[model samples]
Target: MGAAEATDVESEYSSLVDFEGPDDPSHPFNWSLPRRVWTTAVVAVLNLIGTAASSIFETGNGQFMKEFGISHEVAVLGTSLFLAGYILGFLTFGPLSERFGRKWPLLCGLAVSSLFDLMPALGHSLPAILIGRFFGGLFGVAPVAVFGGVLSDCWPTAQRGIAMALTVSLVFSGPTWGPVFGGFIMGSSALDWRWNMWVVIIAGLSATALCVVVFPETYPPAILRRKARRLRKKTGDESIRTASDKEGLSLQEITRVYLIRPFWLFTTQPILALLTLYQSFVYGVLFLFYQTYPVAFGTNRGWATSLEYLPLLAIIVGIFVAAIGIVIHNQLYFRHHCHTPDGVFIPESRLPPMIVGGILVPIGMFWFAWTATPAVAWASPICASVVIGAGMYLLFIQGFNYIVDCYTTMANSAMGVNGSMRSIFGTVFPLFATQMVHALGVARTTTILGALSAALVPVPICFWYWGDRIRAWSSAKVATF
Candidate 1:
């Protein structure tokens, strides 16, 4: 893996310089499975902590509205703007990881995010906390999208399905559990909403510390470039270059790729567009339920404070259950579909679970919405949350796996676009969820959203049928490693 070896290998290949060999120890793919598991676990934990920040703010939804003397929508701007910041952060950090490397940007992002996370705890005013939340979320982008890039760095496609399921499960389960902690904190008359901010700071800092102590560079191109640099210094051969070293972009080009290209891919690629839409709507509905949770339990059902937060557990359970279900489905249904007749990994089979999820989402939504009132048993809505939660997690599990499989080395860029778009949708949903509920009533509002979800059933269907043709038209520059 040294520069001299790299130079000799480059000379040997003539066409391209890849790892020294298929089993190059420098490659993450060649790492021991134990090491890969540890890396995946660390990245998953960071992603969980980052996503939790978004929903924990909602646990204090009541206090924020009252303190600022703002309307519900305006109060929602605290979490809304925080999520909106995700759009900005994602546009930069995930793509930045592609250009620079994963570890540095990830650590820098965590450091900046932790600082911003602490800001809200110190500030008393709503505008101040809103700004804090915005910056905190803005800086958290690395953990959100780049984790996929990290996972892709280590796990091969077959094992990647379950690894991604665990990552996606935590990505969601963290937020669902955040409110549980937030509820207990806010429930106490002595503790203020700021405690939620402090909790995130402590956790974010802890995760950052673990990352610094343990995280090794996983980006293969970055690793090879380092070796090339060393080889030049050792052999005095400035001509030695990793493939990525020769193909590297200037800052201007990198910036343009970051700024303009995702919009292009998002708008142009049928597979990316459809998957984004499906995940976005399902994501939006999850956040909407965040706003509606209190109304469903505390306001309508007259449940106690502690019990009101308990229902969020249904979704958490469903996420774990759905992760298991997807893993099982991958083993059974996708065993053959993952490989072509020639044994190359096929990415489109990732869409099958998504198709099943699309069907389940509307059914779950309709079930939850109609059974949500006090006239129904409380268990009905909570169980309905499970169904909705399972479907949402399934979509997420499949969506991330699908994108990674499709884009391969450029997975970060694709997921950056995917994450940015969905975060935008999540930001918009909470802002109007209460308003929608008020105007239409919870049952009618959720039912309407469910019907909207049902309308998009053809999205996954068409992708399953025609994904290869769509990929042939995609503009994404996928690198073969």
Candidate 2:
């Protein structure tokens, strides 16, 4: 080759490796479509496995109570501890991901969580199982915090609605299917509760393996840092540097961004604060149903065996079917009206499905509570669960998408804060589920939750109307609509 041609080629290569600005092609936003989709799928699978493991043990709570000679409240701790661990995990892992990068932390967490999943299978004691479950959740937070960040890194704001909808749908669907499968496994005389843990452990292992294989490094700063390191190594010159090294926060500064900033946003932003509360309450109610279903179907309604309660699968199917309409709407809005650089139309468009979901939630709860009697037939309550599940997904989809639209650059941090609060609710709600039903009766207990649901309907209305003003008032960083 001629010297001039070689010089020109060198200039092009140098420009590609510069990585000095927002326009860098190495950024995750510029990754090829196949790579982006594969990364998203891996993250989604990790979330699904983590969530599935959280509630799978609940299906065998009866056997756990029998074997451990513990009260219902104590046996419930197996589920509660998992959520508590997740709460704590979110606080720690979210910031940690910002520091060390997404891949290592997620891989380490999945490894630790998988190990914890196996521990309960080996230990016979209740306390051991509880401890193991708690640690499992703690490690499992990696997927929850990192997945949204991964999505934000790859997908544009307009396209993210459908991607996030799929992710949340998988997360919600995981716990529902876990018990269905767990019931079948535990119902077999040949296997016991240990099989539940084993099944989850196997699934976790499979997901972890898939993640390690298919998931590439998506975080842009981390990629550039690695490139800088390689350049320094090859040239033996100390001047090589990444864009992040020049402009990014120090470890202490990043810590403040990850830890303190979320609290600031939580306290100062009315929209974030209110949405957090509404989402937490809905999440709590959903977790309550996890415990309530076993009691309502198995004990109160005279289901003779483990298999008899399997009709709860209908609720899951119904939820998926109803969620499809919301997904379709999200896709349609994005295709037509949601095209905006500043992300205004997306948030406004989320309100319609959210309003419909809010109405369905309370109506379904009332229906289930009133018709739970054996004489009414089990289908009555199952149908109610369908409505509740559908409503829950609707609220979940809107809340999540709204947050993503509002906080474009800091979406992961916003999700981390919201996730911590939701986990706290998940941890607390199941403990009182049985007592609430017994003291107030299912009809009254659920009516109270339904009333709460009804009250929250106005939340979306307020957001739909005054959302622009609220964002304008916020001190925390958010997109201007």
Candidate lDDT values, in order: 0.81, 0.79
Distance from true location, Cα of 477 in model 2, Å: 9.2
Alpha carbon deviation, residue 236, candidate 1 (Å): 8.8
List runs of model 2 lying over 4 Å from the truth: 1-27, 30-32, 247-255, 338-346, 475-481
lDDT string, candidate 2, 1-481, tens digits: 8999988755544423455576667888777788887788878878878887888888888888898889999988988899999887987787777767888888789778989987788887767888999999999777877777777778876577677777777777777777778878877889988899898788877777766876788777788788978988998766666555645577788767777777777877787789888989988887787766766777777674565447667666656766688678866664677546764454566677887888889999899988877779877888888888888888888888887777766666777889899999999998999899888876788889999899999998888898877776663344321
TM-score of 1: 0.89
Candidate maximizing lDDT: 1
Q: What's the distance in Å from true for residue 449, model 2?
A: 1.6
| Deviating ranges (above 4 Å) for candidate 1 | 1-19, 225-247, 342-345, 407-410, 473-481
Give residue 400's error in model 1 in angstroms: 2.5
- Structural similarity to truth (TM-score) of each candidate: 0.89, 0.88
Residue 292 lDDT (model 2):
68
Model 1, 207-251: lDDT tens per residue? 788779888889999998888777778887666776775565777
